[model samples]
Target: MRIPRGLLAFGLLATLSATAFSSEPQWVEVRSPNFSVVTDAGEKRGRDVALHFEQMRSVFGTLMTKANVNLSVPLQIVAFRNTKEMRQFAPLWKGKPTEVAGLFQGGQDRSFIMLDMSIDNPWSVVFHEYAHQLMNGNLEVRTDPWFEEGFAEYFASIEVDNKEARIGKIPDVTYQVLQQSGMMRVADLFRVQQYSKTYNESGDHRNTFYAESSLVVHYLYDNLLLPKLAVYFDLYLNQKKAVEQATQQAFGMSPEQFDKVLRNYLSSGRFKYYPIPTPPAVVPAQFTVTAMPLADAKAVLADIHLHSPDYQEKALAELQEVLLMQPGNAAALRGMGYLYLQRQDLDHAAEYFRQASEHDSKDPRVHYYNALLLNRGSDIAGTDRMAAMKKECEAAIALDPNLADAYALLGFAQVSSREPEKGLEAMKKAVELSPRNEGYQFNLANSYMMNRNMDEAAKIFRELARSNNPEIAARANSELAQAEGYQLAAEGAPEAGSQLAGPSDAQSARASNQGVSVEENGPAPAPVPSSAPVHFVKGKVLAVDCSASPKAVLSILAAGRTRKMYVENSARVIVIGADRFSCDWKNVGVAVNYRDRSDGGGDVVSVELQ
Candidate 1:
């Protein structure tokens, strides 16, 4: 099932003995290179969560091809020590009301997994549901229910430490149920969806379903059937073929035949086991203390409460108190940005959002709101306004894939920039994620019109024109008129123009570019010539840190030992034919280009995934 609602309480470390008795909950927020983790479970727990997810981030790159996952969206995890601890601080989702050990949610702008740390094995629940979230958010297409659940359960049994990941060996209760209940028919398994009655049946039958599905998954992929499985997923996912048809074509076996083979295989004692003897070590991109004072806690609360109309005044008062203590609090800055945005003060809003981004570069919400500010703000001279907006929106989405507004903004920019088909897809996803959001729906209609799908655009506009909200209705009516040949605007071909749009100072300063002012540590280093001897290093990436303001470091395991390579902030990152933004250096199996430095280190110029 997507959520195991009945399993109550998550397992959290019992590290801080004193905080439990405090009158008010003291919160700690940990920022990793790839994650923003908040916890009332204390700083120790917060750091522990960061370390765990960081390890998972490295392992995940190996789990699938880099193309299959969206590493850009920073993963968010909220793990409270227990239900009692969670109740003390109301998180995005209040889990105290229910018994679920954990729940994972994926959105257009962000994805998060909430875990209750009270359970004996909370990590299992985390890995299980996280697998689901990752697959859903990252995969280009929806996976079949049988395979999806099976894949999740398969990973749920993983056991990991600092140095290694032991797969397929962890004990699973489902395996015992599978042994006792025996095998299930393959066709029946394929027909079961998460919402299916069989899957939710209140008995051992449901357990059997989960167990058998995972067993089949293990047999297919773990038992040297990955190539066939990959072909099946390709046909089933990207190609959008019927499941039975894709399966037949990819595996060359009917469901019944596969069932017989699976049964025979299960009867045999042979099952796949995998152990990574030298798995990548977990390294925090940037490690810093996450402890906060009570005033700052209130600031974070103010930021959270700003979203609710009823609590705006209360939050403003809280922010006033917080800013009095810490003037540069990112949360307070973000709150001010949001307030200005609500008041339609675009310039001030943009400034505040930018300030917030500068203060907290790892915070996805900061980038998300900043992107919104950029989209609503005036165009800059040197920047491709549409491209800049799209880039910020993409970065926002990369940090939080579930953020509907980011997708909406990117879709609008894509349509404005004349990528109609791509715009239509993004806008459609935005509307799907937030059906009640009028802006997303309106942009989707615009995208359809841009793609010249007048009929679909008209349908959406017609529906929206009936809404009781006057602003939406008026805009929809106007769009409907345009869709129905009202000649609101005439199309024109693009004239020749300069393609190399320069980045703004703000854009240049971001991690993607080398615009940060470098501090002079000593005498100016001699510049390497363009004709300098070039060297290549091909190996698995052990670590990557672009968090440094003016430089990025990559640690690659090549020729046995780890080699530290320094990359200027301006170094280009390429991922073959894929979009450059999707290229993440931390991923395994990247190729690096560099010049051997005089100090024995390598100065990397470019990193490519080919």
Candidate 2:
């Protein structure tokens, strides 16, 4: 009985009260630089688990370094003392035993693990699932099953104590199965696809499959085939060639010869357990531990569920109960801030975020959300709003250097304020921390383009265009077409302030053709080219004269002073959030191209709402 992460749903049990579980157990969170461990197993036990995971991080980090694979992302773990406690929290189990030691749930932006601490050697289950989470993203769409499962199973036997690791040892079950069964041919194992029934379900074939996969991986490691195997694996994952072809190219050995060598190695007993040299002392991520009431923990769960749209209703219900029990809860407040932001009620969202930030000033997430609201408001409020957003982002990064999204938000603020180079560096750091995050990737790509590194920009854009997500793919293609000097047909109107990149030279070009038009059906006349160089300026509309119908004169705040500019009736007009414009200038906040004319006044070449 496996509870798929995608299917694991929870809601407030309508009839249950926080007091119902008050006497059962209490939860506390132990945090490390790269992992968070939440458990009801007492403070000492929680700290021990945190340290254990930190040790695992060091061990795995070293192995991945040797293999030249970068699995860099913080992880979270939720551990329960027993199945009963797990059911109370998870709700989807409906009081049934999950029959598993641990479960790993991965998403495009993050990953987490849930486990029963009472299970025997639960660390092994953690290692196995962690391996899957790491490999799932980097391994290409065409990765070989033998290598995937074999590599995960091989790492599952890791044992660490005080910085020393005993590696390549077989699990008891694998050892037993191997001792009872005949060696599987390498060719047959290599041909096994992930969807094969034997690999996915229970049977004698599945048992043998695990044993043989582990044996082959150990064999490869013992014979020093790891480097070549790593290259072969990378090649296959990158889809550079078929697995069979990559295997031959990487090792220069026929499948039959490889099989013979593996069988001989297994029989020779040369593949034995080995010990890693003592690792350097690791400074774990520091976290504060407060004994949280059951209701408070439930609030945190509600916050987590709020990330998925399907769970929002349930999250709201849970949050209501949480607020009932603990008024002014930081988590619940932040969750409401998120809900209001989604609804585009910026005023309410800002109020909630400000309250949450005041409640927990040191919390990185609160600051992050505050930064988001401030950034959105910057479009209408000018430089001061942008400065505030920058400060909030800096606060978040200072509190949690590993919060990748904070870096991204900081990057956006930097770019909008006309410091493209500084923005690019921040965006790069964000991508480095969470390479699998498409949003971060998109920001990095856009930053690169803004910095005039077209080659790098095009490379990322091409990759994004091929993404599995339709909307992302469409956006990527649109950006790529623009990069290549063409335009994608507009898809309705995008919600204002939606795209990661805001008003810039590049974005101004796209907006000129994308949204603002005199008539809905045809292209508007191009803005008059300034014989003199043009400068980009962001400001709120001070006043507009539409008495002259086809032509309008506008006064706006640019560069700390009021500048009047002539706006031709043919000028491109765009509203950021609404996507379309009615040519009315009321309540307009815009980024415009200011061109100096021979008459000693500036004329607007393009006017784009921010």
Candidate 3:
């Protein structure tokens, strides 16, 4: 259902000059409850765009039986007056701009939907991408590429009128394409992945893949077999069953039999669609429209370029131009700060963020960016610095309560400051806001570990160890092993290196670790004693001296100071969040727990790659 960015960029350049306006078009911003539409297509079209999105969002929630359908990341819709203007923003192929009726660009902090208003109906392509975003926000588990794309295609044909919305209507072009380029086997279709050549390449085979995927979903919906999809996925993914076996078990038929049935259904030309009354929440009359300054509008375009890898320089130029016209423009300042942040120029990023904050104290993004910059800096070991980061995160959350990233960062800061209970609560809130984010889930697990809740931590890590993302899976597996070790230690196992001789002995050990004296008569019930008093530091590894083989020395930059940490045995040292420890590691962010050495340095206990 998702069109490749390359496809959106592949068309003749001759059509670029087809439409022209007699006078410069005015840009306006249309605001609804859940969406923002910035357009040169007049207020009517802008209001219609906002209303359509609100209606679609409501319909998605109703169909899924979800109470909230809001996306975690902010989205901005840009409606160009004509194809000519839209072409200018399209992705470039071989140094030339490619034509497109609509394009969707996704990012971590924000997303964009650009439409060519000259076209009568430019919603299909954008709608497909929109469906993917909605699923990402609502679904807890990642589904197969086939199901994901097929379901998006199934919902992409949604047509809305004043009273109701019609869904599941297949376009005639799909049938024509599939007929011309014969379908693949059902098993092969099910096995296709996002990285498969057939999914990435542009050809008749790819066209047929999309068309057949949609037809299969349509068949499932019409036959009332949609509920069985969970069974199929559980068999294929969790049980590790083959595509053919899972399909046979879930659909009550072999792949070959299902193929025949699907072919017949396609040939019979009989399909059903769903009609549901529009929710009353979507009211176009209540939407607000206001003229936006040209400089500010250009800043949004610059932000779009900033998120694109190929257009960073153009983004800088546009931001500079905006600043020249309006020196104190808050949006432009924030964009500049983000641009510098992406480039890893921390000083400039900090300065721009500081200026932006002063100019617009109420902007949540400025506060969020400040927090992010602090998190990425090397001086976070200072309590005051960490408190500043937490304050920024708190400000951002107060401004935008649904900002999941702010809660995530706040949780990290709290954990680093040794406030495990507060960290756990903040991390839970983050996961509640963005349930599908594996990274947030990983952080939540880490928070549980800090709170000494090993069972909960291990459960999350076990689930994440099976993730499709290789990095997250590797990290989860490593953390899962550590969590198990912690659980054993908590149970007073000798193998975990924390077992005490007796309860009195454990109290004495805990008092010794805490630098307190034990009572002469009898000590009160004491918590389990850890290995030793370990100091935590988060910073960059400046250099590694491995001249001593197993006993390597590390130069780390923490709290704006260089500290020397000695590793007893590099091979035996505990490493988390990475597959293996490397003596050559340098300039990478890392968190270390170490004990103070007699030489005024540190003896490394564990290292966590950040």
Return the top candidate by lDDT.
3
* lDDT of model 2 at position 610: 54
lDDT-based ranking: 3, 2, 1
Candidate 1 TM-score versus the reference: 0.53
Predicted candidate 1 versus true structure: per-residue lDDT over 408-492, tens digit per residue: 7677556545566887898887765555566667778766755667678878888778665676686676556545431211221
TM-score of each: 0.53, 0.65, 0.83
520 in model 2: Cα distance from truth in Å? 32
lDDT by residue for model 2 (354-428), tens: 788777798777787788766555343545666777898999889878777888889877776667788899998
The lowest-lDDT stretch of 10 consecutive residues in candidate 3 is 522-531
Q: Report lDDT (CA) for all predictions.
A: 0.63, 0.65, 0.80
For candidate 2, the lDDT comes to: 0.65
lDDT of 1: 0.63
lDDT score, residue 149, model 1? 78
TM-score ranking of the models: 3, 2, 1
lDDT of 3 by residue, 1-610 (tens): 9877776555322244333322547789999998999998999999888877887887787656654587777789999899998877789999888878999999988889999989988888998999998888777778888888888888787887667788777779878987888878899999998789889899887888889999998899888898899899999988999988999999999999999999998898888877877667767888889998878888888988898877889999999999998999989999999998876677899999989998999988889899987766545455666688899999999988878899988987776666778988999988887888998899898778667787998899888999988877976776676566555545554433433223355433432332222233332222222333456677899999988655689899988999998886564355655766788898998877676778888887668777
lDDT, model 3: 0.80
RMSD of 3: 10.0
Clashes of each: 26, 5, 0
Off by over 4 Å in 1: 1-31, 40-45, 67-72, 87-96, 105-108, 180-182, 199-205, 233-249, 264-270, 277-281, 284-286, 295-329, 332-367, 370-408, 417-610
